[model samples]
Target: MMFGVNSKILDEIVCILSKDTNVESAYIFGSRARGDFKEYSDIDIAVFIEDPNKRNMIAVDINEINCIYKFDIVIIKESTSRELLDNIKKDGVKIYQRPF
Candidate 1:
């Protein structure tokens, strides 16, 4: 598995995001995504959704999942910074994107 983290974690995360119709997409970035993560490395999850409040709610849902590492959730938006967006797009792994 990726970085020794539980695959169930990713499965549950995608399941949660897929349940939410508003979520346009989701990605896993940062050290974990790059396969250079240490034991203390946290999982960086970027969620693309319309409602900021709803996105926060989704983050809460994800946080409910128990794990050894922390989950750093970021909501992707039009107002997101170019640098971060570029990094995520360039290196991030897309986990889920709602069907059209």
Candidate 2:
């Protein structure tokens, strides 16, 4: 898949993911999130959910206003551990945390 993203697109993705009932939080990771993207880098997203087993999630590509970006959703059990949160903190730059 062609990999690239911008703040406007990211905002749209966050909005979409937030609408999902299973999702509690959404985040962006990896190169695109770090502002050091190349021509080929899949946009990585971390999705926090009420239950991973509740449903299967997939990446959604939303195009509007001619903006392009890859949006991915990951589902984790709602009760996430501190370690995971810490890891997100350690790699915080890659995370585009949703604004509640």
Candidate 3:
């Protein structure tokens, strides 16, 4: 229930993401975060990681997980477009972050 009470898939997604030490933080955006999801809607996730090169590793890890929902993982970085980053930051729901 990271994004909201209706998002059960998010809990499972977080478990997979949390195991990766490179992952700094994560957010959920798009229809799922807005609470207007259909049965087949993919969960859009934006992640800030320690190394951008680790993006592929993260994708493989997430894809291997047996989950009912599809996850679209986006890597957020300084080089990423300002407009797209702003939009996600504005609407995305914070779902995970590494503990200090």
Candidate 4:
């Protein structure tokens, strides 16, 4: 149960996403969240955004980050609806959460 990337990556992601108005909560999930990730396994990230229209910007940000870093992407919108957020939190590991 060891994580691949160091804590620096988490800090970097938090810092990067925090600066953007589109990003709400950025959660790290999959093997990394469970602490069973290997060097080959890409880090799974679940990003919750405030505006649904900003998804394109979120994707661009993630893609830009991935281009510089190595990881997989999964973006979810929190402000869009409660249903999806509940489902994601219930299903995916709650790596990060922003209080409304």
RMSD of each: 1.6, 5.4, 2.5, 4.3
Worst ten-residue run, lDDT, model 2? 61-70
The true-versus-predicted C-alpha distance at residue 23 of model 3, in Å, is: 0.7
State the TM-score for model 4. Answer: 0.65
Predicted candidate 2, C-alpha RMSD: 5.4
For model 1, give the RMSD to the true fold. Answer: 1.6
lDDT of each: 0.86, 0.55, 0.77, 0.61
- Candidate 3 Cα RMSD (Å): 2.5
For candidate 3, write residues 39-82 as lDDT tens digits. Answer: 77887888899888654466667766676677788888778898
After superposition, which runs of candidate 1 have C-alpha atoms over 4 Å from their true positions?
51-56
Error of 3 at 16 (Å): 1.8
Question: What are the runs in model 2 whose C-alpha is more than 4 Å off?
Answer: 1-4, 58-73, 77-87, 93-100
Candidate 4, after superposition: displacement of residue 27 in Å?
Answer: 1.0
Predicted model with the maximum TM-score: 1
Q: Which ranges of candidate 4 are over 4 A from the true structure?
A: 62-69, 77-100
Q: How do these models rank on TM-score, best leading?
A: 1, 3, 4, 2
Model 1 Cα lDDT, one tens digit per residue, 1-100 = 8645788988999999999988989999988888989988888999998676552578889988987778989998778899999989888999899999
Could you estimate the TM-score for every candidate?
0.89, 0.57, 0.80, 0.65
